[model samples]
Target: MTQHADVVVVGGGQAGLAAGYHLRRQGLDFMILDADTAPGGAWQHMWESLHLFSPAEHSSLPGRLMPAQPGETYPDAGHVVDYLTDYEKRYGLPVQHGTRVGAVRRDAGGLLVEADTGIWLAKAVISATGTWSRPFLPAVPGRSVFTGRQLHTVNYCSPADFAGQRVVVVGGGNSGAQIAADLALDGNAHVTWVTQRPPRFLPDDIDGRALFDVAAARRRALDAGRTDTGGLASLGDIVAVPPVRAARDAGLLTAKPMFSRLTASGVRWDDGSRAGADAIVWCTGFRPALSHLAPLNLRGPRGHIPTDGTRALGEARLHLLGYGDWTGPASATLIGVGRPARDAAREIAQLS
Candidate 1:
């Protein structure tokens, strides 16, 4: 039997929930299909020590402000999970948990959303599946020959797992900085942090809120047909969160240039310097999880579904939300996703 809805939202993460909030306001009948068995989306899987660079109040969805975690300046992953769980219930969003969507294709009537649980025919489809599941591990030479344990940001849980081992942390982003700091602060691992370029840290005062403002300003400029202002890229790469700041000041978080290639036991640099390692943690980031939409054959040269605002150019009835700024400025962040979600919902409603 095919379920029917005006809109079928894939992925019950922050992006999906934000879209749900707006869809409800538009009085559109919709169903959210979540791959996870529980609420909290990807936040549930983040490392135990992971903390948001912004405080709870500043990191939130469209309708509700995230409650401040008692005695914590920046709330951890667990706190975010709790907030997302609560937010979903508070809005009474109709989410079908554990229903993993397999593919999205055009239907004679509308769009067909084939999932493990069932098939949904919806007038519009919102692909809000964020990138957590698609961790990207770059192909460095000799990577396959390395005998040491290798993991990506998604597999990381705690520094204790790698304690007393020589671990190499790769990538220049926030995850790389935080994980390296976590290992160093644990005081048990011999940690070497490496990046393609020298790690750039945002000013100590900068946080998610500041980054969002910069993104918004850039968006306004772009809308006004002004020159591109670089947006968040104008700011440095890493946010100097408390843990990272402490680790940097203590010289425990210094990043070396990325290694030239992996050795059987560890890695080697262009300078011929070699380091032995028990494990390598790749925080190289992720590609958009858009495999479900492959049947559409809509990807452009950059491997992105070309879009005007949130609406897909290849398929007008489809909206791509929360992949990144290409969909909307700062659309991937907690606070930043709201505007894009609202705009997407509004557009869907208008089209309906």
Candidate 2:
């Protein structure tokens, strides 16, 4: 049986919820299809010690502000999960859980969303599936032959599992910094943190709120046809969240230059230095989770579907939300998703 809606949203995460909130306000008939069996989206899968870079007040979706957690200035992953769970219910967003979309193709009526549960045809489709499930591990030479246990950010949960092991964490981003700090603070693993270059840390006082503001400023500049004002990239890479700061201040989170290759026992550097390891955690980051849109044949050489704002250039009826800045400035973050989501909803309403 074909399920028909005026619009179909492919995710129920922060981005999808933001889209649904605006869509509801616009009086558009839409349904959000979430692959996860429960709410919280990717937050539920984050490492046990992970915390948001901003306070709860600064990290929120549209219509509802995330309530501050008791005793936590920067809410943890579990708190985020609770917030998202409540956000959906409070707004009564129509979210169908456990519906994994396999592909999206053009249909006679509109776009066909083929999911495990059923099919949906809609005049407009919003693909908000963020990158959690598709962790990207760089193809370092001999990675396949390494004997040590290897895992990506998606597969990691707790630092306890790697206790007392020699662990090498690769990547310069937030995940790598956090995971390395988590393990080091646990005082169990001997951690070797490596990045392609020296890890850059944002000022200790800066957090997600500041980053979002910078992105917003850059977006405004671009819209006015002004010279490109640097966004988050102008600031450093890693945010100095409490734990990361503590670990770095204590000299436990020092990062080495990236190793050249993997060895049978561990990793080897270009300078002939080698370290043995019991496990390797690849915090290399993720690609946008857009495999379901493959049938559309719109992805370019960079694996991104070109877009004007959130609307796909190749498919006007489709909008790709919350992948990153290309979709909107900071659209991937909780607080940042609202504006782009609102714009997408407004555009979809006009099309309908």
Candidate 3:
């Protein structure tokens, strides 16, 4: 039988949970639909070595703080997964786990959410589905002809898989840097880091919180009708986490400009030098996960549904949260997502 809710959240990660927290505060009935069989959201899929760049206190959702684990300066993926699980229980948030949302379309009543398990008719729909499900890989020439393994960050699991192999890790973001470091140190792999531009590194002391503050300051400047520099640090600017610092200290963090194209066996540099590689790990990042929203035909050529604040521009009852800066500045991060989530929830409540 088809069910219904006042609002339906399309993701059960930090963003969706944060939305739930605020929805509950407004005394609204909503259900979060998660694709994962268990808790943890996308964190459950990260490579085992991944850890939060920020400390525990700085990486929390609304209404609850993630407790610091002993001896863990920064919580790892497992800790985050556990925290997300606990956060759901602690707040008593109603989450329909394992129900993957297949589509969301507008009906006469409101929005109809079709999931793997059942259908939900909601007065409002919050699309908090983050980008992890859609990993972006650049279309380099000869990419299709390459014989070696090619994997995106979403599929990357551990360095052990690439041990004793020469692997080219593309992208300058934290995922590429962290995975390259892991392969170099833990798996004895010869790793080459490649980026479109030189990777910028924040000071060793700088963390996620500092970056968020910079983003906020830039946002405030923009709001005041002034020029915004977007701060000296961006979310993509690599943080000096312990492993990254260690990699730098060992001279393993050097970055090379992006290769001109992919060759049959490896990549060819702009200088015409070719390196034989057994595998290529692309950390090029992700596009927003809006396939479910495609039925609405609201996406532009860039695959973005334009928004005014948290509300989707064309579809007033539809809200987009936690995709990235386009949805809300710093919305991709844990602490940063709460602002947009709260705002979206309040807006959804008003509609209800």
Candidate 4:
């Protein structure tokens, strides 16, 4: 027989973990279903050499300090996994790992979730799968004819992995910028990054300290519909700078505007330019994965759920975390996910 609970959260990343914590604390029956073997979804999948821009103190979760070692810059990818693992052991949070959700449906009474492992019925479901599951790669012309290995930055593990090849990286976001910097410093390959528009880089002293406060503040505003950023502006694209320009000044790399087509042995630009390289890395952005949630009535076009005026997802009974520029402050931070989670749990409690 299928297990029943008061709530069932999909995805086991920070959002899901905090949601689970809130539900349990409120004495609500709930379980987390995760696709990975453990928590820390994308963090665990980061390129092996990555270190978070935010320091560990800023990366802390609901009730735990990520780590408080001075002189320790933000954590490497491994540190993220370690932290999440500790979070599991720390709280003994009940999570079912490696369980692929099949679908989520609503009946007269409540939500029913089906997964590869089994079926679960709950009063509500929290969709915490942030916008990274499906990496959006543009349909470049002649892409199939390219006679080189092509990979997304999402799959990149380290600079050493591309030690001896000419790499063409597409996209100007944080990921592409950092990857280009890494490959150039190692003297491993000729790195050419492509982004239509260059970003504004700030001074080192600026610190760009946004991890905690932004996450915390946005959570309350997003849920209450009183976010100060106003309408769609609240969810505008957010970019954080972390000393990326220093790499640009070094002669090892240069960024070009993106081209529209791919050739058998090189890339072609829209301005009628041509760049030949041994490999191509697409650094395109991400979108949320909620195709499995069609039955749940959770989303509209482009994967945005029909939340109540962008404040709450549908009602207070359900809450969306880490969506829309991570604008709902508390919902976005490692330390802040709890506030919204707690509020969501409280709202759920009022439901039954």
Alpha-carbon TM-score of each model against the true structure: 0.99, 0.98, 0.96, 0.87
Q: Measure candidate 4: CA RMSD.
A: 3.4
List model 2 lDDT by residue over 1-352, tens digit each.
9999999999999999999999999999999999999999999988888899999999999888999999999999999999999999999999999999999999989999999999999999999999998989888999989998999988888878997899999989999999999999999889999998889999999998889999999999999999897787778999999999999999999899999999999999989999999999999989999999999999985788999999999999999999999999899999999999999999999984
User: What is the C-alpha local distance difference test score of candidate 3?
Assistant: 0.89
Segments of candidate 2 deviating more than 4 angstroms: none
Off by over 4 Å in 3: 232-236
Estimate, for each residue in 27-82, the C-alpha lDDT of model 3 and write its tens digit.
Answer: 89899999888888899998988999889999999888999977998999999999
TM-score, candidate number 2: 0.98
Which 10 successive residues of model 3 have the least lDDT summed?
A: 228-237
Clashing pairs in model 2, backbone N/Cα/C closer than 3 A: none
TM-score of 3: 0.96
C-alpha lDDT (0 to 100) for residue 60 of candidate 3: 94
The lDDT of each candidate is 0.94, 0.94, 0.89, 0.72
Q: What is the C-alpha RMSD of each candidate to the true structure, in Å?
A: 0.8, 0.9, 1.5, 3.4
Q: Candidate 1 clashing pairs?
A: none
In model 3, residue pairs whose N, Cα or C atoms come closer than 3 Å (at least 3 residues apart or on different chains), thus clashing, are none
| Model 4 CA deviation exceeding 4 Å by range | 69-71, 211-245, 251-253, 309-317, 330-332
- Per-residue error (Å), model 2, residue 322: 0.6
